[model samples]
Target: MTTPTAPLILFDDDHYMYVFEDQASAEAGWEMPDEFTVGFDAPARPLSMTGEPLDVRLALAGEVPEEAELRRLVADHCRGHLRGQVPPQATALADFVAALPREGR
Candidate 1:
């Protein structure tokens, strides 16, 4: 008897379910970063494109930092890569920081 193999799970939001298909299709659809560990979320989280309240997932590669530390790290990364100015997004780091419900800021 042959042993059954567990399904592979790849996590790009758009391609999340592509694992059910063949390897080529899965490879073509897999585009999420290889790094990152899920950490941090927003207060009074916003709705998704489907208009459903969605939990915001933020991640950082190895060595996930504490909230305050993460904030500083993100500031540095953005300043360096964004040329000291980040492009506008519906939700942003500053917005997330300010939106925190506690005195951590």
Candidate 2:
């Protein structure tokens, strides 16, 4: 098991944030990139064996995301992952977001 690189790459889609080692791994194993859970901060960041900039790309992907970014990602994930009936996690996220004071409203 080789050590993962510091400056990783992230591929963010509608639902999940995929972690990659490099541009090549990101491109080759795009179909099955390592899934990153939004909002929840892990002890260590996810490492991908295989590996750029598409939807919402992050340069320092190894570092934790900011609060606003987390909220945005969570919202997007909930929106895309939700279907038929709303999942418990999605409902929780919605309630959490709703409780937060907005700028105007």
lDDT of 2 by residue, 1-105 (tens): 333332232424445544343434444444433342232222123333323322232223355435455455545545675445332243343354334322223
Model 1, span 26-98: residue lDDT tens: 2343333342222222221211111112322222223322445435444444565446664233355546444
Would you list the C-alpha lDDT of every candidate in the order shown?
0.31, 0.37
Report the C-alpha displacement of residue 68, candidate 1, in angstroms.
0.9
Highest lDDT model number: 2
Off by over 4 Å in 2: 1-12, 17-65, 84-105
| C-alpha lDDT of candidate 1 relative to the true structure | 0.31
lDDT of candidate model 2 versus the reference: 0.37
TM-score of each: 0.28, 0.29
**Candidate 1 local lDDT, residue 25:** 34
List of clashing residue pairs for candidate 1: none
